[model samples]
Target: MAKTVVITGGVSGMGLSASKLFLSKGWNVMIADFNKELGEKVYKELSSKYSKKQVAFQQTDVSNATSVTDLKTKTSQLFGKVDSVINNAGIFTKGALHEVAEDAWDRIMAIDVKSVYLMTKAFVPDMIEQKAGTIVNTASISGLTGDYNMAAYNAAKGALVNLVRAMALDYGKYGIRVNNINPGPTMTPMFKANPQSVIDTFKKASPLGKLAEPDDIARVMYFLASDESNPITGENIPVSAGFEIYSGQPVQK
Candidate 1:
């Protein structure tokens, strides 16, 4: 039987790209997202390409335990055992520490960090029963280093990076793996909303001199989910195109 995977935020951006990649690899996929319209649309689109039996969509609010549980239940019904769960649903916010709005802080933490906990709670038990599974998170370079005006996002992703580490330790004994893919500035809808100057700066900072496409991150997500990375867990693999390698010094011509 083909392996089954659940991908949150699987309607758009990197999540959508990853869903397609997994389908192409002949995996049974359940795409979970908060947007019902987009979810149904993507479900139809993918169903046209692959068999309906191999693809499904569940409208989910990942931060909410009840919704997450429903997602797990439906996915299980559709695909049987989930071989992997990709926590790719996330929201981004920008502001200095004190300038950050209380609601923004709470919302970002709830979506980016708490959702992972809820997901693990909902799925890991079944994984443990099966004695095999993988969990992949969509983290960011900001989690590893500070950003000028992104305090809340940094803190949330930072928590996620460490969460992956802690969960790996807790779950690895059961033959489950936990890891995150930390991508630099990617040209997702969120990045495209930034000022052009800000986008240009990110381009210049990367040695590759360009932003990552959604597919770029999706490929790494696939690697982490596959048996190819069985020995790797509790790790944050950077798909940043060398954006983090700079020392912040101006190069002398």
Candidate 2:
């Protein structure tokens, strides 16, 4: 029997690429996103390309406990036992500490951080019972390092890095692996929304002279979910084109 995976935010960007990758690899994919229209559209598109039974979609608000529970129940009904869960749904916020709105901070924290807690709670029990599972989180380089005028996003992602570590320690004995992928300025719709100067600056800063594509990030997600990385857990691996490796020093001619 083929394995099954649940991917939040699976309608677009990196999540959409991951959904495609898993389906191509013969895994049953549950595409969960907040946009019902897009979810159904992508569901139809994917169903046309692959086995209709191999793909499913659910309109989910990952930040809410009730919505997440509903997603878990739906996945169980549609796919039986989930072999993997990808916590890839998140919103980005940017502002100085004092400039950040209270509601904005609350929303970011709830979506980026609390969603992980809710997902683990909802899915890990069946994983524990089966004695195996994989959990992949779509974090950012901001989680591992600080950025100017992005206090809320940085804090939320930073919390996720440590949370993955704590979860690995708690769940390692149960033969489950938990990891986060800290992508560096990928060419997703979210990143492309920035001004051209902003995009150029990020690309120039990267040693490879380009930002990552969604497929680039999705490939690493696939690695963490595959048996080749069975011993890897609690890793905040960056798929950024050596963007985080450069020091702020000026390039000498």
lDDT of each: 0.93, 0.93
Clashes of 1: 0
> Model 2: what TM-score?
0.97
* Cα RMSD for predicted model 1: 1.5
Candidate 2 residue-wise lDDT, 106-177, digit = tens: 999998999999999999999999999999999988888889999999999999989999999999999999
User: lDDT of candidate 1?
Assistant: 0.93
**Model 1 off-target regions past 4 Å?**
193-198, 250-253
Against the hidden reference, what TM-scores do the models get? 0.96, 0.97
Question: How well does candidate 2 score on lDDT at residue 129?
Answer: 97
Q: What does the lDDT read for residue 47 in candidate 2?
A: 99
